[model samples]
Target: MNKIRIGVLSTARIGRTKVIPGMQRAKRCEVTAICSRNEEAARRAAEELNIPKAYGSYAKLLADPDIDAVYIPLPNHLHVEWTLKAMAKGKHVLCEKPMGLNDGEVNRLINATALDPGVKVMEAFMYRFHPQWVETKRLVDQGAIGKPTSIQSFFSYFNADPDNIRNKADMGGGGLMDIGCYQVSLSRLLFNAQPRRAFGWMDKDPEFGTDRTFSGMLDFGGRLSTFTCSTQLAPYQRVNVLGEKGRIEIIIPFNAPPDAPTEILLQQNGETRTITFDACDQYTLQADAFAEAVLEDKPVPISIMDTFANQHTVDALFKSAQSDHWENC
Candidate 1:
């Protein structure tokens, strides 16, 4: 059995806490290298994770011929620039989401990937790979919810640490880019098309210039989906898909660790049912799925085009928020 030699671009929180660990546990992946801006940090992370190599500069890591792929968990803004650079080096890329700051950036990425046939690029949306969502999609498609009409999603956390990357403005830190993108992307997954329009408002600090909270409505061909996201306030994360006949509700949406079996709350006419499923190791599953795509030459489950459309909606929301009027999404 051959192992996929994987190098991580940064010792960022997600990379350190999840991606690196997930890659280590994946049967198809062999953690080859880890890099960070600080040499000490890189060394420490490499030692702790038991990775073979560590580098101070991203350029050094990318230049290594032994590495077959790179997982990037850089800030939201650097996603495109760095992913393209890695792909240019003939390395497959798994970039952390909110693929880019906007639709134009995603298009730029699409153009870049056109040059690398063998070096495929994927957005790391671990939630999408989880069996809970898969089962929800199945139930919805099977009419577990009759004619899925709406989706209500929420993701929030109190970010008191203003120094965190999620609060940095130039890094494209904001509730929308960090968390709302999940809701928006999930909204697209609920159906097969992009939303026709989006209306939203965001709260931001004058000094920080990053959104603290955001709530919005996405009209996917008039189905009317709504989502709320925040980084500076609240303690909640849930997603509910409502149809005419019933609904499929997830009590815990994101960050469902190893044993978190998301209870699928199904409520129909007069009676309610709850299905407890085996917990999905989303991060590991995500790594395996990407490996399958790379190893077997199969299509990625989540489409890059879909990433483009999600950015389109996000770009439009920023526009609408700026103008205080409904805008094309």
Candidate 2:
């Protein structure tokens, strides 16, 4: 099989530290190029990552005819712009999470992809591709958890740096946009339903103009989900799914260790057992999934429509926080 030549759109930390290397490990994915705003920085990354080519600007990378796909790890606000541009250039795209700043941007992203149905576009939610989660879904489907009725998630990391982009409101910085997004996506996926309404409360950072702490509840018809996502709390994360018969718990739900084995706690019939997953790189899994989609003409796993629903729920949560009432999603 011919390898998919993938271009790294930016030298973002996630790209440099995790995703690019994972792409290199993925089957049929070649990390052929790296791009950054600074030519020197791009060259430095190219040398460090052992990429053959480097481009000083995103446009240059897009213009390269050799690139079959692009992994975009740009900031939250730039996701829509670069993804649209990359897809327009006939390049399949795997863009990082919170694919847009709001529902409107996601709608625009959907429209752009609709205009070019042949091009594959996916939101990079790496955790979804992990075997642990896959097994968890299988268990749920097989009624190990009976009928899943509710979910609760917590994702938090203490970050008070005012200079960080995650603290900048204009850059789409905030706990909700960063980590809460995962909670929302997880809830929807586990429930297999979109939220009908949402309620939220947030505490803003005075200096950063971003939410330091955010908590929200999502109503999925007969089921309900709640989450707390924070950038000012001690680092920890978990997801719990409750059903009529039993409950399922993901210990390191979101930021799972790439090199270490992980397990899920299953409690049913008054007994508890741990299901272990061998150490696996979800980033690599994500890359290979995208490569498979592009190379074999299959659909991208996480569709823009799903992203729109996630972002729409996020938007509704924020709106609910402002109005101090449940907001329709």
Candidate 3:
């Protein structure tokens, strides 16, 4: 395949505003179609994005023989459903993060993928594709920060609209599901170890039954990772990694803007150094990477197995908060 002919599974805000534009700029992919439950909405999105085709239903989009792959930005609850559907139709899938609500559902998708060995599947953790994170791993591996010891990450934004899908518990709404997942995944990536024990403290909105704010810790043997995520705080994000000899600080860790330069700070041996990176769209990089994997028959950079492990940690954090005790992952 010269370029992956992609179809978007939904006209979600992120799809139209970020991922589609990123796909357009990516070298090995083109978004050929878009789908929405409402025909007018799908038409509007297709027109705005300059996509060649639009379908009123997701099923129709999946059935399009021209679409070699599908980008799913549906709600969290619908992720597993449509991913399985798309894969069953022989289309490779790039589903949004937190692929399933729990381990059982995640396992189902894993099994489904196993039956279709030729199709590539990946969770859309765009940050993992960013050069900033690539440098972070290099610094750790090169021992620029000595033996890594801990990580602290924070992500938050105020959004309390009752009608918003993110505020609905049944739709997989919560601070952890929305943004804390980033912390859980990042800590594991930086440490290169699975956390054995987890603990959490959260405050739920009584009216919504969704966690509005949460703080959690993961014990990776002697090394510890702690994070606080909120859907009701002023918008802010950062990640700090401390080691025996020094520390690294990422100013805009999770949601770095695509059009602006980014940087990370390293402090060691009584001196500090700053590393800078040019602006690049992580979403575009993610699309291109997945396309290359599909075209060249290489394993996806962010494997579904990694997402399974991340969700396992997420489940432990939720269990810990409810039981008020440490839980093993």
TM-score, per-candidate, Cα-based:
0.97, 0.99, 0.99
After TM-score superposition, what is the CA distance of residue 137 in candidate 3 from its true location, in Å?
0.8
| RMSD to truth, every model | 1.3, 0.8, 0.7
Model 3 global lDDT (CA atoms, 0 to 1): 0.94
Worst 10 residues of 1 by lDDT: 255-264
Q: Compute the lDDT for candidate 1.
A: 0.85
lDDT of each: 0.85, 0.93, 0.94
Give the per-residue lDDT digits (tens) of candidate 2, residues 1-329: 56899999999989999998888898879999999999999999999999999999999999999999999998899999999999889999999999999999999977887788999999999999999999988888899989999898999999888888899999999999999999999988988889899999999999998999999999988899999999999999999999999999999988778899999999999899999999988999999999999889988899889999999999999999999999999
| Candidate 2 or 1, higher TM-score | 2
Error of 1 at 281 (Å): 1.4
Residue 126 displacement in candidate 1 (angstroms): 0.6
Q: Model 3: per-residue lDDT, tens digit, 153-241? A: 89999998998888999999989998999999999999998899999999999999999999999999999999999999999999999
- TM-score computed on alpha carbons, candidate 3: 0.99
- Clashing pairs for model 2 are none
